[model samples]
Target chain A: MEKRVLMKGNEAIAEAAIRAGCRYYFGYPITPQTEIMHYMAKRMVEVGGTVIQAESELAAINMVYGAAAAGARAMTSSSSPGISLKQEGFSYIAGAELPAVVANIVRAGPGLGGILPSQGDYFQATKGGGHGDYRNIVLAPASVQELYEMTIEAFNLADRYRMLALILGDGALGQMMEPVVFRDKEPIDLPKKPWAVTGTGGVRPHNTITSIYIKADVLEAFNRKLQAKYAEVSRREVRAECLNCEDADILMVAFGTCSRIGRGIIPIAAAQGVRVGLIRPITLWPFPSDVIARAAAQPSVKAVLTIELSCGQMVEDVRLAVDGMKPIAFLGRSGGNLPTQKEILQKIMKMVGR
Target chain B: MQAVFKRTAGLLNIPTHYCPGCTHGILHRLIAEAMCELDILHRTIGVSSVGCTYNNYEYFACDMVQAAHGRAPAVATGIKRVHPSKSVFTYQGDGDLAAIGTAEIIHAAARGEKISVFFANNAIYGMTSGQMAPTTLIGQVTTTSPFGRDPDAQGHPINVSEMMATLPGAVYVERVSLHDYRHIIQAKKAVRKAFRVQEAGLGFSLVEVLSTCPTNWGMDPPKSMDWVAEVMIQQYPLGLFRDPKLEESK
Candidate 1:
């Protein structure tokens, strides 16, 4: 039986990481996500894990990179600006195929955007925020329970694929308190990382982890191999949830907190005779394109509406997923303001000619 | 004297890709010889930095990781923390270390990360074909500094070892030159000491080796060495700046 407790989303992620065997954490303080660091700092020491308050976002991400290269399950948390500073390290880690978890409790941003809740970084999160041809396994958590669940899965996916895994949340998700069940009380037995730099006791040769390849041909080959791994991930790892889409006329697409809002409006819209259905993407990067296409193919489905807290970032992905089978519309609110149920309801009403 | 100059055991026996008279050959030999003497050949992990020697993992018999340019120190810090028993070191060049990776090295040393950094300061960016480096001396000309390195406009040369020694985290810091036989011998000693400090469980250690780049300096091999000795040494002195062993002795 899983132990159930009332916790904030940020706290659940911190506790779930401990349960998932993350022994090292490096992060700088950032709004809406600072509680995760604070919780880990207190709890990791009790569990004999290491938690460091890094000097800067760059230092924190590099520290995570270091620990990941050493084959330790390490993580960092930040908002938009801090995450931008971490892109260089993230790119390097992805290029090197090092496993690590990054929690982005996203806030609105072009620059120093706001501390309020917003889903403005959909493109940056799913399409690779860093330089180079690489992708992170991006997990979108809608609630506190999902936060706990997704963070643990993020570690597992990162380790299995040897790539960066991201938990993409917003300020609302980070700040919201809800009940969560903690799974696996027993110490997790992580897979033996043979590639890690665990000291050579004269029993084995030394190991080094880096991304620099001088020969252009060799570097190109390395890139191709990484691409192959990504392709494999895409085939095997698409995750999403369809709520009442079977007989629905309008399919509403959203993720993270926006999905929760969209879910809330589903019954209300149904009562108003809108017949709107909701499709929530659990994994944003290995997007559920197949599911979206299937939803779009429905003859009764009028249009695909994508709702987010940004100026239409995920709409492009929704458009790509629908592939012109139906019209795609976007309703966005930016600069830390989350869309209200009424606003989303109005958008759906207007779209369906109600 | 029947071929006393044989390849080290842990080094590949293939011909090096370095240009004729490149100091990388000398530096590689010095590190390999130190590893052999210390009996840590099997337990060493070399983190190769971005530069001409980026693919140095191919040469070293031990396990190797190629770090992003300037991020070797951070990578080494990670490897050392996870496997404290392993001998972890980063081989970095001037551009990779002094310019791009300045924050990483400084923070690693400041945090007292238990790793070693072998800095190859050739004054110019050799791998990029003679661009001006952070350590490029005043009035020295390179591809980017065609009109001579204007000290007034472009900052003065950075003395990395001196800067690092000021940090409380560094347990060993030294600057050595490979411009001559005497300096080369001293340079080897400095490299050995840096490794020993790490082996003894001391904090961050660094050895900045003043080397010659004949191709980038646009001089013959011998003249490059002479230029390094005469001009480079005057700007960047060579000596041990910090040693935890000496502190304990005092």
Candidate 2:
């Protein structure tokens, strides 16, 4: 039997990343996300990996860019403000078509709002946080176990698509402790990175890893290729967990820690005789929109409500996904505050007109 | 009845977009020669700067990556750390290195990153039609400093080589010029030596080449060479500023 141990969410991300064959971790220290760096700093050397406590978030992201270009499994983690600093490098990484994993342990922020749990970066992560035309495979984990599992999966997705992969979590999930199991999973066989900038060793034509194409036609072609990749990812990789969504009058949509709150709201609403179900998005970018629309399309479902840690960021996507088929509502707690299960249950009851 | 000379295989056989007398071509040739002689052409990755040479990836025969304006050093740092066995070098201009990328280069050097830097200091932003650069001389006139640079207003010119030499992580630092044949040869030697330092796993190494922008400087080819010798050299002197091995011996 595998040993189950209690660990912080951030530690699970680090250990899982190492087991996932990530040998390079470059990050700057920030609130709610520093544990990832601390764990890596302690054990990376023993695991024959390298941990770079970079000067700033900018340096950290660029280091990941270099390591990724050289065909190493590289990653960086930061909270809201630090992730913002990394945007320039992110744009470069996307343009260069390098595979990298970035984790944003979210804190409330327009600008350094507070070091607490908030899903304020929904649009930034799902949309383009960096400048330019690009998309990242955004994963949102609701539990510590999922955090560990998603981190390992993130590396695989990144290499599979040759694109940026993002894991979005908030301070609450990052700080929370839960029982986690470390599994000895078999290694995944990713395709050879023939385009990596490793020494050619005089074996083939020198390979250049760049995002620059001065010609308008060449750039347009490259953009078309990227769009094709995004389409394939969206078609094949949309992930969501639907619970009790079958016979419901009200469907609740949430993700990350908010989903855990929704899980609590379900049992309470059931006891009170309200048929409220959930469609929790695990992949936030290729955002399980079809699942959401189908759940909302249920004959018994009358309304959809999105509860987030921010003021209606993910609600926009829900609105778009639902297409005004049903009345949609939003409830949020911003600036590091969290909503309670009672509040969500009350909202569900009101939506049911009871 | 012999082949007098041949272009180094490290450079692609294509005409450059550089102006008739701009020393960027000279610097490119020197770097290519260095790569060829070192026999690291296959294993080398060049990080191109976003200046006049933004598309230099097309000119170099090795693996190349074009970095954002002023981010080549950071990008090169990334590439080198992952594949330490491969040779990594960043080719940057004055505006790219001295202005926007100051923090990146300084930090990469401070960390003792094992990479070579080829800094082309033309004292002006050549690509964007001649704005004053960080290395612009005090009395130099450009689009930004039309009435010549006033120190009180614009601040003093930066001697990047001297500043870089102060960092303990910087193992080899040299400032060379591409004015005449003699200095051009020396500049080539400096480029080779900088790469050698990285090949030997010495810490950060850089060769600051004082180049010319004839089109931007409003000077003809020959006059630009003279200006590089007579004017640019006086402000940014040509010499080796740091050598770890030499320092240890002393």
Candidate 3:
């Protein structure tokens, strides 16, 4: 019988990645996310895997790019500024169509804002943080246990799509500790990469892994192919949770730490004679748009309030999903300020004419 | 009748996009020959940096990965760490290495990564049409330095080989030239030795080849060769800066 082991959220991610067969980890130290690197540094050695405290985030991501190009499961972790530094490499990895995983334990930022949790990077993660026509599978896990499961699933998704996968959690989730049961399970599906850059050994034609297409037409065709892949992902890979969404007049849309607070609000609002439902997005990219659309389509749902740790980012996606079907409101704080349950409950009270 | 000359199997039988009179073709040939001679062609994975040879992946008869500008060293380090038994190398130019990628190259050597680097120093940015490079000599004129490079204004050129040799992890550092037949032969030897150092797991190795860019240098192909010998060689000297075997002897 397997037993539950108490682990930090960051440690769960590190340990889970190792179990998922990630042999290469390159990271540079950054706030809140530093523990991920520390854990990997200690454990990777025991597993005979390669882990390096790179000189900078740029090098770390490029290292992931190289290892992925060579057909090895590779990942890197960093916070806000560090993730910004890695954007160039991320673009290259995406353009080259290499499979890689990156964890952004997001901290407050427009620039060096604070080491506290903030969901300010929602736009950056869901949209293009790097300069290019590309997207990463952004997995937003709410708890330590979810962190472990999603990290393992992230590797498989990255390989299946030949795209980058991002574990987009904020500082609060990164630091929180809880009991995590590391499951003994096999991969969902690990596909063979025939186009990896491992040496041909004179048996096959040499494989060239690159993103450069000097001709305009060739590049357009490649972009079309990538768009088709993303379209398939949108149709098949969306994940979200809808709780008490039926027979409800008010719906709260949130994710990550905000979603945890949202769950608490459901009970508090219940005592106040208010009916509220919540939809928490698990996949930020290829976003759970259809689920959101379905929840908003419920005639009993009168208003949708999008709460977050940012001024507003994912609210835009929420608006698009709702599509003027109901009145939408955004309530939140930005720059390391997290919304409390009391604040959100009060906002809901005003919205429901309490 | 036996053929007097033939191309190395290490390079593909295809045309290259390099400008006429550019020595990139020569440097590519020397490195390809070394890969063939060392019998490591099958297991060699090359990192192509952003420059003239960014697409050289198409020319080398081995696996290749193109890296972001100045990030090739870091990329190559990742590849080498994963497949310790496989041969890995990066081909980078002056702007890619000495300027933008200075940090990566320095740290890769400092960490004693067992990978080979083929550095091309043409004293100008060839891909972007002749900008002033980090290895551009004082008083040397290019598109960016139309009046001539001034030490007080643009700073002095970097002697990358000498700087790299200072790092203990850089076990083999050599600066060679492809200005003439004799020096081309010597440069070939240096390229081979760089790979041999990585194969021996000695540490990092680099071969800085002083090459010419005729179109960007505003000279004929023959004059470009002469300029490398007379002008470029003065700033970036050709010599072995570090040798693992020599250190062992000492």
Against the true structure, whose lDDT is highest?
3
- Give the per-residue lDDT of model 1 (tens digit) for A223-244: 9999999999999999999998
For B1-250, candidate 1 gives per-residue lDDT tens digits of 5896777876767677899998998888889889888888778878888888888877876777777778777767666666678888889999999998898899889988888889999999988799999999999999998999998898899999889989989989999988888889998888888788888888899999998889988899999999988899899998888878733321
TM-scores computed on chain B for all candidates? 0.96, 0.97, 0.97
Q: Model 1: how far is A328 from its true place, Å?
A: 1.6
1 or 3, greater by DockQ: 3
| Model 1 chain B weakest 10-residue run by lDDT | B241-250
Provide the TM-score for each candidate, comma-separated: 0.95, 0.98, 0.98
Q: Which candidate is the best by TM-score?
A: 3
Question: What ranking of all candidate models by DockQ puts the best one first?
Answer: 3, 2, 1
Compared with the real two-chain complex, what DockQ does model 1 have?
A: 0.50
* TM-score of candidate 3 relative to the true fold: 0.98
The ten-residue window of minimal lDDT in model 3 chain A covers A184-193
Off by over 4 Å in 1: A185-187, A199-208, A213-220, B1-3, B246-250
Candidate 1 residue pairs that clash: A206-B63, A208-B64, A208-B65, A209-B65, A210-B66, A211-B66
